[model samples]
Target: MAARLPLDLDPPVRQLRALLLGVDDRELIAPTPCPGWSVATLLDHLMSLAEAFTEAARRGADAGGDRPPRPPSAAHLSPHWRSRLPVRLEELATAWHAPVAWRGLARAGGITMPAPEMGVVAANELVMHGWDLARATGQDFAVDPRVLAALVPFLSAAPAEGTPGFLGPRVPIDPEEDEWPRALGLAGRDPAWRPPRSHDVPTVRRGSREQPPAARRA
Candidate 1:
């Protein structure tokens, strides 16, 4: 039988790289559905988070602990995200995915679910934002089923109430299917998104709460 791909970001990075392969490097610098982030900025943030998570996962694996810290704030990350973004992302992904005994150790601490939490987070960024990037730049993209499956629980997870923008609409769950996309739909990010032929990205309509400005990549 073929080797089973990890249903997480380690393998899914291949999918993200493939989505980006044909697109112009310049489009990486354009504006996305995200408000303050230009495409370049967004890509940098995604890549940065992937790298950061990988490090955190490594730490978690090594010590059998919870996740590492969030990536440094956007203000601190902006210069590098714009300049050395791709290189950093590549390095981090590679380092984190390296073979190590810590892989199994990460689950021992109970900080994340078994089988690497960073992979889950990475998978979401790659799958969803790959679609966002494709839509923003007019490239075609498709989400992997494994990636989507991982997001089901991530979106259903709730932050404390009054957590500002994190508290999105309370979309009901089917309990039988994944919750992320449905949550995205409730957030106006599902099938409604369409890419521009040239430079204009589509705007999201707010249904209940005034559509807050698009979130900046962190």
Candidate 2:
């Protein structure tokens, strides 16, 4: 079905872009939820994945079918990362918009699979890692309910824990919970994860009252 060829990716992609843009040089060195990956390394990984998946969507001569996927490293990040990454994210969404992009087998990260499945994987990467970046940076984030609903079945069937370089053990949650929390649990993320409370979120004070600052999001 034509529906299988593409899922509108622009929303999650844009959300990811917002998170990336908000990152600063100081924050780049901060660690992410991904084990051993700092913000810079994670951004580098996103850049690599975006390029790989774009070629995968192309499935054409220009696609680097013969080339093995590059290992993501902070050293590989471009000096122009601030400008380059957002554009690459846009390209990733655009590349998948074509119906032909999903017509056959596609390869990314040295793995080949049906293009539709790859497309869904792309969505998962954007959302899950977007959450990772937000949490690591102490930013507010929310997924569209429909988006989480779409991912429920896939993550639901996935293991509670994963190996290094994959999802870690699934955090416990009420099985009958909101899709967002449930999805996080299924993705091996603790729904309760928080930035170190060493005053990571500052407090605000009015003339007579003080209020704890909250994470900001769009």
Candidate 3:
């Protein structure tokens, strides 16, 4: 397994923080690529994950088997989230910067695993969700190539199609496409997916609205 480097995480953390800070109240209620989560709900989830992973770093591998706290809900949104989340993101990044955090095992959600592997998982979550928010709000999202390369192995190992909590069936992509599209494709997201437009809704054909003559005769 490829070990995650602390520097590999820095860009995504910074990007996610910038994205979160740019969100306005009107955008908070918007739906994201995450099936059931709105922008606000996703932010809450990120905050909880950051806190849990930070604690995991502090506790290290030998800290007895204890699970991280449950992720917070959309209702947990507060006036301070815009300020608080960035601070938490920084804390998460800083904690992992310690070389010791990458050695040995780490406990998260009561499961102890190699610290480096968990770090990759955290990085994947941050980058993918950053895309989710950007796509939802019509903002440009670009991941650093180094970060994308680091995450490729993890994306390649994603669960098979139809797995719960994952995006729909994987969308095949041309190898010639850009790195981000290829990465998104392997991660089960459609590289071409765009937010639905109100005018794009399906319309009934004029004559098709009535039963066909063949059906009436039958």
Candidate 4:
């Protein structure tokens, strides 16, 4: 039997739902701190994760086997994501809150782990993605200290390099900074990162030489 999930998981779940509620359709395509992922793309990923973890909590270690590939398009955002995601989020929270859900091993993303540990991973996912959405869409994002504290062990356990799905190298952060910044940095995201301005052009200059007329024209 697995241990019970920590009592503090609900705050991150609630925070994620609140961020989802504030997203507007017009902002779906806005770039987020997550490299190459727009708001809509990130939301799609979040929804898929919620579904996977919810199923894991409901079914123990047998769940999330042979998971379906996530759709590339943001079609899930149609019919208004606000109407859809919050309901799913609520269901996810409710499923994980059941005492039985935390009493055995669970599988998520094809990896089987203790149910209590998976619960912590679920909450971390919510908080991280919530911050991504809020930062991209210009909403105020504040990390729940409980959520941050819960994730510290996981972060500390992560390798200094070679972790898949991270955008860049782990950014070094001062010990005196708040846990929010420390956590983001450990996850290989800069907490102070903002989306590039629309007018900024990415130029590839070879040896500081301008592109030839033919290449430029092409």
16: Cα error in model 2, Å: 1.1
* lDDT of model 3 at position 183: 83
Clashing pairs in 4: none
User: 64-183 in candidate 2: lDDT tens per residue?
Assistant: 666666767888889898899899999999998898887778888767778777777778888998998887776768896666766878777766656456567878889788779988
Instruction: Report the lDDT tens digits of candidate 4 across residue range 19-81.
Output: 776777778888988777889888888778878888988999989776654653566644555
**For each candidate, what is the lDDT?**
0.52, 0.78, 0.76, 0.76
Q: Which runs of model 2 end up more than 4 angstroms from their true locations?
A: 1-6, 60-68, 197-210, 213-218
143 in model 1: Cα distance from truth in Å? Answer: 1.8
Most lDDT-accurate candidate: 2
User: Hey, what RMSD does candidate 4 come out at?
Assistant: 9.9
Candidate 3: tens digits of C-alpha lDDT, residues 1-218: 55545545778899998887667788788888777778888888888778777866777776435644565568887678988899998998888877788878887666688888878877877888889888777677889888788788777777658345434566799989987898888777887766665566543322235444565679
Residue 3 Cα positional deviation in candidate 1, in Å, after optimal superposition = 11
Extract clashing residue pairs from model 1: 28-40, 29-40, 30-39
Query: Candidate 4's error at 16, in angstroms?
Result: 1.8
Instruction: For candidate 3, give the lDDT of residue 143.
Output: 90
Scored by lDDT, model 4 comes in at 0.76
Where does model 1 exceed 4 Å of error? 1-6, 25-29, 61-115, 159-183, 186-188, 195-218
Query: How many backbone clashes does every candidate have?
Result: 3, 2, 0, 0
